[model samples]
Target: MGGGGTAYLTGYEAAFINPANLAVPDKSTRFSIGIGTAAGFFAPVMSVGSASRQFQAYKNYLDAHQPEATAITASEKQLILDRNYPKGRSRSEHQHRMDLILGGIQWRQGDRAFSLTARTRFSTRTEVGRGWYDETFEDLDSSTSVRDMSLFQQSQFLHEFSFGYGQTFDFVSGLIPRVGKLYIGIAPKFILGGSYLDLQYDARYWFTDEMDQPLFTRSFSYRSTGNFSGATRHYTANGDPSAAVQRHFPSSFQQDFSDYTTPTGMGGGLDFGLVYVLTLGDDLSLAHSGNTQPIEKSLRLGFSVTDLGFVSYNENPRSLDHARDTTLTPFAAASGQKYEGSPGQYLSFFDEVPDLNPFQFNQVGRSDDSPERPFKAVLPTSFNAGMLLQVNRLKLAADLTLGLNDSAFNNTKLIAHFGMEFAPVKPVPIRLGAQVATDSPTLWSLGTGIVMKHWELSAGAQFLSPRGSPALNLSGAAVGGLTFHF
Candidate 1:
């Protein structure tokens, strides 16, 4: 289904492809939103905090200093000594989820045009365990023991907006005879970003009920962790002894986000394009030319680049929490006691022992998992290119897109798309397309659309590929959207 409308040839579905191509903005004002789900091919990785180890370390320090006593309730003790401390959350995304909601208005007044577009996107994820537990406690029910185990999961959303303008001029007499018009355009964009990730998990253990009926306990938990890493020295709780805590974290997570305009200040970029018409007949405007019929329409070619410039972020170093010390209290094993009083007492507690390094992965307890690290934020970039054939009412189109990581770390991905449109009736049409990529499975799609006097509507379905790995594969997607012209 090739050869049809001007929009098909330029592939500017939202006027985002090339602002200049929007010169003759469609009369219909439209809005479009797309939703898709993908499987994360990778297994979910877990992070945890060691409450037991932390308690043991605290106990050792207390024994050495022997501070004033303060009795506490069972609930208080559980809150202070529980081994499972909340350690924020983690997310596992399967693949690219094109979850975007959009609305826009295009204004076409003769050869000049302008458009405004805005969109918001939402995404989700989850993780299941390998099914195993090593930590065990005495069971009360029937003289049996139980281990702690669980399943973990999370979800995110973002918003973006852009405004553009385009102009066109018939210039065949100025340049080549076959060429028709030159187009120029530009757009400014503003993006608002924020997300909420809820990490939920279930831990199964044992606790005796009042009836002494050996009861099993199930705990549903959540954590709220933020990005911070640094070092500090201060008196522990009471004024007993001075202690230092060190926080270890990656740089990516600590970036400051106070300022949020265009990442590179207030600067913007421009987009340019050209549409040429080739005629097969003799020239009508030429020296000693006889009467001739000029060609009205022919083949058309188009090209454009969006966001070709860059936005630089603010340069500010982040503050970090200090890593903690495992042994401030010296142990006197021969005497089965320890001194937490001061450096003098610590020296006395351990008469002779090997010196240790302060900066270590310090294992607080017997558990194998490392302490949960601070979370990180990531931003992305994308590039697009496409072509279209216009022959009366039939329009065929194809496009290529690449997404690149422009953040602290980088990964490259490419996507290919092909589609055709057929318009049997003046305002209604049917469309079909397929997406191909090396990193992703092939996706086949079918769609239909309508262009009314002032509004445009479209609906589509896509069947994703990579036939196997059902748990981590993208099955299919249902997409629909609307656009408006002012």
Candidate 2:
């Protein structure tokens, strides 16, 4: 619920959050199996300067008017540019994430627990400067001189198999009457790298009035490295395939399933967690058989460090670099041609223009068919800590997550989540949650779950908006899962 599972989750659902919780499953559950999926997007409009206000205006305009228009008017185009583009140098970022739990099983006996899970994760991020947006929509007569304008994108997909174990320690339970038990857990994961892509583009442009046609000089460099066959391809300057370059491109997803199943890389990772539960009244003896008597707890505290490893991609990996400086007439457009197709198709246009000929696409790594020097991509590591409080039929929880590094899946920022759950009836529970981050708008979520003796089902949705402002659900997410326990 709103990414607040660090402390209170149990059974199979705790495999990814805090494995220590697995050892504290329901009193009657000895085994559990589950499947789940989640997807989300975050495109924060920063509240610095007028950019955020303009973005809201632009969104409102689109929502109110634009459902039936075939062609955009000049006034509309100008209005869009004025509203969306920043006044000076600025940047915007967008991120997307998806997770799939193919299957998972958890088994607990006495004070020990074990789990195995198979899952896949995908994430991507894109960042662009204001100059890039202005260049795309501004009129030809608009004189804009921009330096060091840049666009960057990174994406990765991976399948993981994890084995986890947790053990409870009650040696100190009797010393502190208020402390119920302590649990520690560790999970080692085998990761299969499905695909990876990193693209960086930078440009400098200036307009010169020295010539009658207003000479425009532009210099740019483009670099990309990965096995993203669906998005990019390479060819020799003669418009033919080079035998020296290994063409690992797959034609289509419908025709080839191996494109996704094949491993472009391989790596390993580990997760560590610790949890302590505090007793409310009387402390239960650890001598009980099968731990039949449940440990009564008023508060629970959890901590974990996850995804600490790297993947080295060596199988047919490709790296391309291109840089050029050219001078041409202002606002020159190729007749009867529109920008379309993949990156390879768009780059082909440079070869057709006389002023931009001699375009050279250089491969950076080894040229032979043998394995190339590997490129290492690190995992999105993070540290999480949270606390949960239980009171009769009501529960409250709060968590804090700190990203250790910046990547497509994680950012180096602190995020806080707060959640509450109330069980009006024994078999049904209602939940409400909220999230706040350093650089993004606030997120609110509502969810419900049905808990029976042998089966469980849950679903939730998230909405994004600024606090104290008109609610504009610019982004949303939906997640659902099913689990069976015995």
> Top model by lDDT, which number?
2
Which of the numbered candidates is closest to the native, going by highest TM-score?
2
Can you write out model 2's per-residue Cα lDDT over 1-486, one digit (the tens) per residue?
566778888766576778888886444778888887555544433221244553453333222112121123445434333433434434445565667888899988788999999888877665554443344322234454433234555667788999989878666545655446777888889999876766555433444344344334343323234435332444432443321122434332234535545688899988889888775655443335357444434688999998989888776565554444444433523212221112232233343443422224232222334323467878888999999987656789999999898677877889999999888996788988888886456778888878887888877766666533465453545555778877
Error of 1 at 308 (Å): 5.3
lDDT of 1 by residue, 269-344 (tens): 3334443333224422222112122222234444555444332222221211222322222211112221122111
Please provide TM-scores, in order, for all candidate models, with all chains considered together.
0.46, 0.72
Candidate 1: RMSD to truth: 18.4
- Candidate 1: count the clashes: 41
In candidate 1, which residue ranges exceed 4 Å CA deviation? 1-13, 25-93, 122-157, 169-173, 196-300, 307-379, 406-411, 468-486
**What C-alpha lDDT values do all the predictions have?**
0.37, 0.61
